[model samples]
Target: LVASGIDTNPWCDEAKKQKKGDNKSRKDVPTDAATAAPSIKSHSDFAEDTATEDSDATKESLASSFGKIVLWMGVVAVLAALHVYMSTPLTRGQVVPPGAWLSYCGLLPFDPECENAYLNVNFEGKVIAYNSNRDVAWEMQGDVCAAQVGSCVRGLELRDNGLIFVGGKRIRSIRVPDKSVSITPWPFAEKPHLKISRK
Candidate 1:
């Protein structure tokens, strides 16, 4: 018998083919560092980065809040100062004659009613009259009160060009011309019932 049919091991042949394929696949995979996927950061490193970002954000927020507070405070301070300046009287120093005389009355220093009325006479004999709102009603240059006069009235004299102020301790009644009225010294009281009557 001739050995025409060689010993054929199909299973062994198939096994050999599979082994070659596995080797080829392994060789195809990238082995170079440049071709590989980027390495992932560790959990600790990621946590640290997040913490740093959060801290920076918090600091920025705090700084912004502080700046806003300071700005508001400055605004409030300015408003307060303005209010005080507007409400306070402008005259300073002695209020008695030879220096200056000041008289005012009303609920508020700026009230248009009797509250804001004021009469001032400076040392130079300059007389100024203001309405309740501190508006200059009239002004003149003269001695308003005679020597030893304590109380006075301001109004238009019969033949005078403008209003005149007269004051004296002995003076009692006053006579005003037709269509003219006099302003008495304000008692510096609240809600005073002031009258402007014809004489």
Candidate 2:
């Protein structure tokens, strides 16, 4: 009872159910056009999230500039150790006077082998004496032969009959000889026996 060839067609079952519904609507129309649109990510995940937010904002701006350069290097090492502790120098306190210090300095030639002299004083009131070979030297500045001599410098003597200079309460004389220094009344001159000659 075959109709001569074989076309059991009911429209070929309705065109095989319309080609299986067009292959299930072409696989659900590309999954519904890839779930209908938006998702876009891959350029390496948006360049790795913009390089991890610019490496966490460059590590928080290099930890805020290394904490302000370690707090300005501890304030410049405490101002260079307080400027080397106030420019150093005044070595441990001072107070001097011992028979006005240099007792007999250079020439006391009334006798005593009559050797050249040598002496020196310190503690601010400088005085120096040298001879023998030091080309005869003498320097005076303060404690003029002490005796509580203060008032800025009130005492000095070198007498065989010459050079005496007391301060504050006055007492001066000068008559250096043997050819070296002389100041006959020329101590505080205004013509008080004014005369000074040295070579």
Candidate 3:
């Protein structure tokens, strides 16, 4: 202890030495541009690197997003294909109603030969009927009459010999007399219009 009640020892000397060392270290490291240039360049480099990383991340995210979109588009296309396949009409093992088959086939264009066969059909039972056509296959049922008249017009008698019936509803073929009973024109057809009356 000293007269001023202060400790005068090696510990006090160490404190003074630490203060001097701190000041000297600060002076040794310059606060000017010359010393700060490296640090400034380093900071700029860090910023540039961060920007590059962000750009890469953005590109990766976009690629991932694009991949997802493509996958969804593929899924949509597959669903559409499935829908078309399921919606198509079937024959034989697949049974379609009389009216639905008619409407569906009517939308498709008919063969010229098929239409031409009926051009000269004027007599009774002369209508050439078909179960299957280029556009549709039908399971026919019930008697067909002209849209104008509910019954057989033009003296067209539906006899057993004139119409070839299998299971009653299905008509295999039609036979017509050489002469028509009436002079009126009748609209009769095969497949869609050659309607057979179910017994």
Q: Which candidate is the best by TM-score?
A: 1
> Candidates 1 and 2: which is better by lDDT?
1
Q: What is the lDDT of residue 28 in candidate 2?
A: 72
Candidate 2 stretches with Cα past 4 Å from truth are 1-5, 9-18, 21-27, 30-59, 90-199
Answer with 2 or 3, whichever has the higher TM-score: 3
Give the number of colliding residue pairs in candidate 1.
Answer: 6
Q: TM-score, each model? A: 0.36, 0.27, 0.30
- List lDDT for all candidates, in order: 0.49, 0.45, 0.42
Candidate 3, residues 1-199, lDDT tens digits: the string is 6998877798889999999999999998868887666644578898999999999999999999999999999998986665443334322222222222122223232644333111111223232322333321222233444557643333223342334322223454333332322111212222222333332
lDDT, residue 8, model 1 = 58
**Pairs clashing in candidate 2?**
144-155
Residue 184 alpha-carbon offset, candidate 3, angstroms = 28
lDDT for predicted candidate 1 compared with the true structure: 0.49
lDDT per residue (tens digit) for residues 1-199 in model 2 = 2568766778779999999999988877655656788788889999999999999999999999999999899887886554333222112122223233222222243456644343444544444444445443544454333456444443333322333222322233223233642221212112232133232
Backbone clash total for model 3 is 5
